[model samples]
Target: MIRLSRIPHQLLTWGIPMGPLMLLRTRGRHSGLLRTVPIATLRHDGHHWLVSPFGDTHWVRNLRADARAELGRGHRFRPVRLVEVDDDRKLEILHAYRGAFGLVPFVRDAFDADAGAEPHVFAREAHRHPAFLIQPAG
Candidate 1:
């Protein structure tokens, strides 16, 4: 599974456009070490955003502990602050994300929304997938 996940990361590292994917670097809340993972990304409401497709994973917990993180593309990484999106706004972003990448099997499986689910359908599953807005960090 880890090997398979690295494929896209490798592609991204090679400067291939993998469609809304990026390398997220975060400080381990407990270990106090840097951890990086490749995850999907989105642009909503004129802001950069990301979602935890698997729900409350390690990275999410780390971010909750410390909002400071890095958003990276290939070899380039920059400082960024992550803000947890509110439920109301998260629903909209989730809907938009589904609309944009719904055809991808994993993305489709992440939500309760079906192939043609309406925006409200996403609202039902919004809490399960945490969404964060990326901001420039000082």
Candidate 2:
């Protein structure tokens, strides 16, 4: 199962250009080396919200250590700083993500937003998802 998940991520990280798929570059939390991960990103109302479909994953930790990361799509890349969204906003963003992406299993499964769930269902645990508001890095 992990292998299956890795293939697409590997493709997006190095070899594909499909939709809004993006490559996020962050410094390794422990190694202090650069690490890249492909992420399915969603943007709304001029704000880019990054969802950690897989919970508070590695890249999330890396960002915690250093709030700056580079967002890359196709050939364009921009440096951005992560401003951790508060729980209230996280729930709202998660709702937007669910509606836009059709309840991604990785996220819905964790937040229990499957089928007919209220948009605010994720509120109680929104902090666990670790969403961020992106801003141009200074």
Candidate number of the best TM-score: 1
Model 2: pairs clashing at backbone N, Cα or C within 3 Å: none
Error of 2 at 84 (Å): 0.8
* Candidate 1 accuracy as TM-score: 0.89
Each candidate structure's TM-score, on Cα atoms with residue i matched to residue i, is 0.89, 0.83
Q: Return the clash pairs for model 1, or none.
A: none
Candidate 2 structure quality by residue, lDDT tens digits, 1-138: 366557666666565785767788899989999887777788987888888766778999999889999988545678999888875677778777767776455555666565355758877666667788888999
User: Could you tell me which 10 consecutive residues in candidate 1 have the lowest summed lDDT?
Assistant: 115-124
> What RMSD, rounded to one decimal, does every model reach?
1.7, 2.3
Q: Which stretches of candidate 1 lie over 4 Å from their true place?
A: none
Q: Give the TM-score of candidate 2.
A: 0.83
For model 1, the local distance difference test gives 0.84
Model 1 per-residue lDDT tens digits across residues 16-118 = 7777888889999999999888888888778778887789999999999999999777678889999998756887888888877788777777778874776
Cα deviation at 40, candidate 2, in Å, is: 1.3
Error of 1 at 116 (Å): 3.4
